[model samples]
Target chain A: MGELYRLRRKIEQIIKDGNLDEHQTKGKITLECGLLLALINENTPDEVNALRKLKTAAEKLLGNF
Target chain B: MKMNSLKLKLISLVMACMLANALIIAWLLLDSFQREKNTLAWQALQGAQETYVHLEENCTRTLSATLAALLADEKIAALYQQRDRDKLYRYTAPLFEILKNDFQVTHWYFLEPETAAPAIAQKCFLRVHNAALYGDVVNRVTYKNAVQTKTFSSGKELGKTAFALRVVHPYYHQGTLIGYMELGQEIDEFLSTMQKMTGDAFALIIDKRYLDQTEWKNVRNRKNLPQNWDDMKDAVLINDVLPNKEITRFEGEIEKIPAAGQILEEKQLGKSLYMKGILPVYDAAQRKVGGILILHDITKINSNMKRTLLYSAVSIFVLTLVLGGLIVFVLNRLVFKRLDQMNQTAIRVVGGDYNTKIVPTADDELGQFETLFEQFRNVFVNAVSGIENAESKTIKTKRPVKKRKPRRKP
Candidate 1:
């Protein structure tokens, strides 16, 4: 529902499609975004920096930036 | 630079190797220089010893020739045979003075030959230098040898406070043995002459065992020299041709010097550096009685060596820096920069820029790797494009009723 949750779901889908490890892919994105994906729920506020960080992390991990 | 990057590791390895090589070269150079300096000091010691021997030989030869000429004078032989002390002294004192002044001859002697009475045999008939001292039994090896062999004998002899090169010839009158004529020179003159010849300092250290301390003290006092009889443990400094008397203070056994000589360590005396050595001094009986300490000034040579080492170190540092810079530059050009280019291109391709290619700068191994990577990128891009096209076509086919509606609309 939230923009952060949408970005997280898109990353999860890319990882599943690529048959990549879920925890490792999330960990890499978390490291890149400097935020924990497990804590980012649908009700979480979509801050501008958080959204930009999530988009950049997803683009870096999945190569669609 | 990244800590674990290949470029950093390669650069670190190169620097370490260069440092190690420079250290090894410096050590080798220093060792070689030290060995060469030591060899030069050893040669100087040997040369000084040889010069001493040569001077002794020349002094002995001159004394022998002079003694022979004096023995040829029938009057001198006749005066010794007559036991005329006053006339002999008057005749030879001026000659002794000339010999002392011109030839550095210090002692002159006339001795009674071996007779049936042992009390009178080898008695000092006359000492040309000292008319007050006479009738003392001459018990020296050279005198005994000349009396026994009845021929010319010459050798180095140690006296109460001095060493001298003595030459003895059996005096004969009308083919009958009369007495002995001897000419002598003090060996201290050799040290001074050798110093002049080689510009090196020298000291004669006689063993205390061969010397009486009272007589040594008395001689030192008589000569107005320092009464240093108790200065050394087993040896006394008899004479030295040194600018500083302190340089003659050695703390080693004179008799322990090797026959060929012993090279001592370099020492810094005042502002100058010196290389010291010792040549064993043997009396006529071939007994090691003393040692000749030789000191050669090596300050200039030592400074030169240090300067050379400093230059070498600076040169190595500069060369290492230059070489390191060149190697780093070449490696960055040939490998690091190109690898970085390949990494950026790979990252761009992963980010959907498939048209971006890896262009190799050289036809080396990295270039070959770049070509293979480009081929793999081409294959991957074509496969992805084909999959995308297939998926679109499948989506169009799967429209079914929508496709029929689309055909009705058309």
Candidate 2:
């Protein structure tokens, strides 16, 4: 969790250094960081999808070289 | 530790090409120096031969004229009649004067008839005492070999000066040559006298005869006559080595005898110097009877050449230092340090920093690559973010597209 905060802070600094608003996050930076951390930290799926076959096809496409 | 093979190979290739260029240039210069040296040696030999021919002509003409005058003289005719020591001595005075003044001869002799112990009758006590040491064989009373040796040497002796020079012409009383006028001039004075015709070069008249013995030995300033030399043997050893049988004549810079004039290996001279031109003296029939050696002291030339080589080395060293410094600087800016920074940036990009970029200082291939990679990174970031956002949401149900063709037809 602390590493995640550090990563979030680094991203915010980059945006600020790029001449963006240093105070406002636009709910994008922390959201993207937090969501990716959840995907990495999650042990299993919380809810089952109705179209499991479609979800399986989407995962296969993302993992392919 | 993912190593980039491509960049490493490129660096090695550039270094190999530079080394190859330097090696080729050095080889070319060495080849040029070898070629120049061969040509220079050949030209020097040719020039020495020309000088030899000139020496022969000048000395022979002088001796011939003096001998002709001695033959015609009424005082010299009296030697055949008086046969007394005092009378012969008086008769030989003007002949000596003619040889000394007109011919500029250092010494001359009147050799007696052939006998086991050859009787040496001479005009000057100084000249006679000197020859007496070498014994009567030097006088050559009426030895037929004396005549042959003199006849054989006549042509070659003209151009040079020596401690001993003898010309055997049939001694004429009145109109006919009766006995012989065996004359010798000292080698040193002969060298000086011949200098007129030899162009400041002292011609050392060296017969294969007793050169290592007395006066001739003292004239040359050099070292160890060829390693294999016999003291009593009559061999033409010039500058230590015998003339090569393979070479028709030997003429070039002396390895030891350093002189501007002809160099003779007269070890008796007790002086050490270098001789430039060493020529073979030949008989009338073109037989190499002896050598007319010329000496040129190369001390000055050798010293100057050494200085030139030193300067050349310094110049090459300075140039290489400057070039190497430039190469190091260029390599640092263009290759090593640049690649190192680029490598670190690439590592960061791989660690999921999608906006990561490398700054390129050069406009070369590597710089262009970095620019391209930066562009790809931007496109990649946009695609990933868009895909992730789209994947995380589901679109609501929408009405299907209606066919407008039937309405248009109605």
Candidate 3:
């Protein structure tokens, strides 16, 4: 959980430094990650199941990126 | 179901019940009004008949007293015993005048009692207004176990113009009957008195044979009489106390029925209902002479009852509508209002607002729904939390294990 938080923060910093709003692709990824983390913080059982599905999607995105 | 639909269904049920109740009440009210009208009509008929009976009794009593007083006079008996016509006339003229002035008797007849008839008419005396009538017989008598005075109503004879209430008294000198006297009173005053007492219209009708007109003499044989004349066969009206405006010139047809004691069918004149009752006036020989027809108006009571019933029906309809509206308002407040609130809260909950709360308004069924909804929300929030915890722990450990590189063991 700590490692995932560190990874998420690094991605957030890169997006801020790059002014990701000016870029479409990176801004889209940053927005999705932020929404995913908010859902996780809420930690509803339904959301957790949704997050498990999202993990598979993230793994696929990792290979593509 | 949607709250709006539920509300419409409930209101429809209430309105239907109210309409059914109003219709039932209105029907009952109309039925009661009809019964009341019939009762009023019946009472009016009974009252008219009873009044006629009481009038007849009073007339008989008064006539009896007057005749008794006249017969008790010794001079009258002595003049009759001596068979002195001139002396009797001289002695009775002034006395008859006094009696006529006080008693309102219009005709007096002196008769000799005969074996063939109880009284054979000898001389006729009248008030100053009427000419002295001659040779009118007074043979009306009803014999009982004892001599009893009875009212004798004779129909018109040849040359007789007026109908009267006739009373006959047999006079006795010592132990043998000498002669009988007959007293006559005009029928108009009796009719007037009865009309006043009963508050009804009265008419005395004579046989058409008594009518002077040639057209009425052959009334039964005539083919083309007026439509109104169909019920007035063999009779002619002598007098009536009906209001002038209400008296159709056909007033002559009032008592013109052949049968005795026949209650005619009711007739309606505008808003007024008229019922006619025919009572036969019999001749001393028990022959049907004429009839007394009483017309009673029972319209006022009938109209009043109908008006009251209409007002009551209208009031009930208005009250039902008001009560129905009140029921709708109460349902909106007590049931639909709470249901709407619950619906709004449920919508918010579905929209992921877990904090949305439903409060119970009563300890009834809806309140139970609120409690169940609250429990569902708690369980849902807890379940969401459990899912998040399990996913987070699983993802963190799997990622670390993946990071530990597998030995390049292709």
Candidate 4:
């Protein structure tokens, strides 16, 4: 529902489609974005900085920029 | 692996050090070998000079004793006092032949005393070796020294065409000086004898300044030998025992050669290597008139040195290879491989596999890092779990009551 959650979902789908190691891929994205992907939900505020960080991390980790 | 890797860099540094050391060792070995060659050449020169002196001394003693024995003959003194050249020759010719055959004596001379009178200026009374070449003035240094001192004189003197070790004794009969009796042997035989004694080649070079080119050419021609006056500049090769005459070629000033000797450049003749040198040859007047070129064979030693250097190079190369391999193996086993393991463990922990603990394999530095990372992973897992629980409780509290409006309508 939130922009950050949407970016997180896109990263998850890319990892699944690529059949990459799930924990390793998510952990890489978490370290790069400095946020936990599993905790991202609809209640999360779609702050401009958070959204930008999520998009950049997803782009770097999953090529989903 | 990348070239910039630590392992490759360390190996490159080690290899560079080893290469530098090998080059230094090779340079030292070559320098030592060169010094050894020069020393051998110098020793050969010294040995040749000593042999020449010893032979000359022996010849002087033998000729002195023979002349002493000849002077005991009353008839020899009587014939010389009467100035009878034919009787003196007839008397001493047989004795001269015996002396030549027995003691290697080659020249026998009888001379008249120096006089200021012009009518008797011919000082050469009789030459037993050359009966036809008489009535000539004896102007040799040995003759002059003997006449001037009125005593025994002996030294090596260079003649018009040859070098002879002559021993001249002032002849005195009944308290009056009669003349000089001299005995000599050609010094050409000294070169051959020295060659035989030392198993090295020798060449006698007389400077053109001290020699008559025409006389040298004539003697060479008479001996059926090649005229060698043009073979060299400023000097002529009088005699040589070298298999190849080209080895005697020298271009430097003969007078500049040191008195003790000088080592020359090494020469390669076909399959053989030779160390050449020069020893100054002095005449009775103590003039440095020539040099004796000495060539010593050093092929075996040179080949041995090269073989030793090859062996050393191969040994160093093999040692470097073995050492490099061992270093790489130890580095990989102790550092790179363990660091790679730590890298993989960190990636898995970042992927949320917190249960997989980073167990330290040793008590070393890497092990200490692993223990610290494991403790951090535990804290991160606990913190994430606490966040998840807080989020679940907030969701439950925010849930809306179900069907409350429907119950009110009923």
- Highest DockQ, which number? 4
- Candidates, DockQ: 0.07, 0.06, 0.04, 0.55
Quote the positional error of residue B299 for candidate 4 in Å. 0.6
Report the Cα RMSD per candidate: 7.0, 12.7, 11.3, 3.2
What DockQ would you assign to candidate 2? 0.06
By TM-score, the candidates rank as 4, 1, 3, 2
Sorted into a CAPRI-style docking class, model 4 comes out as: medium
Q: List where candidate 1 sits over 4 angstroms from the true fold.
A: A1-65, B392-410
- Lowest lDDT sum, 10 consecutive residues, model 2 chain A, at A37-46
Candidate 4, true inter-chain contacts retained? 0.57
What is the TM-score, restricted to chain A, for candidate 1? 0.92
**lDDT of candidates 1 onward, in order:** 0.84, 0.45, 0.60, 0.84
Per-residue lDDT of candidate 4, residues B291-387 (tens digit): 9999999999999999998998899889878987888788788778877776776666666676777778789988898789889878878887788
What is the TM-score (0 to 1) of chain A in model 4?
0.88
| lDDT value, candidate 2, whole model | 0.45
Candidate 1 pairs with clashing backbones:
none
lDDT of 2 by residue, B104-135 (tens): 56555554534212344322222322334322
Candidate 3's clash total is: 6
Greater-DockQ candidate between 1 and 3: 1
Candidate 2 lDDT tens digits, A1-65: 23333433444455556675432332232232223321221122333331233234323422321
Q: What share of the true interface contacts does each candidate keep?
A: 0.00, 0.00, 0.00, 0.57
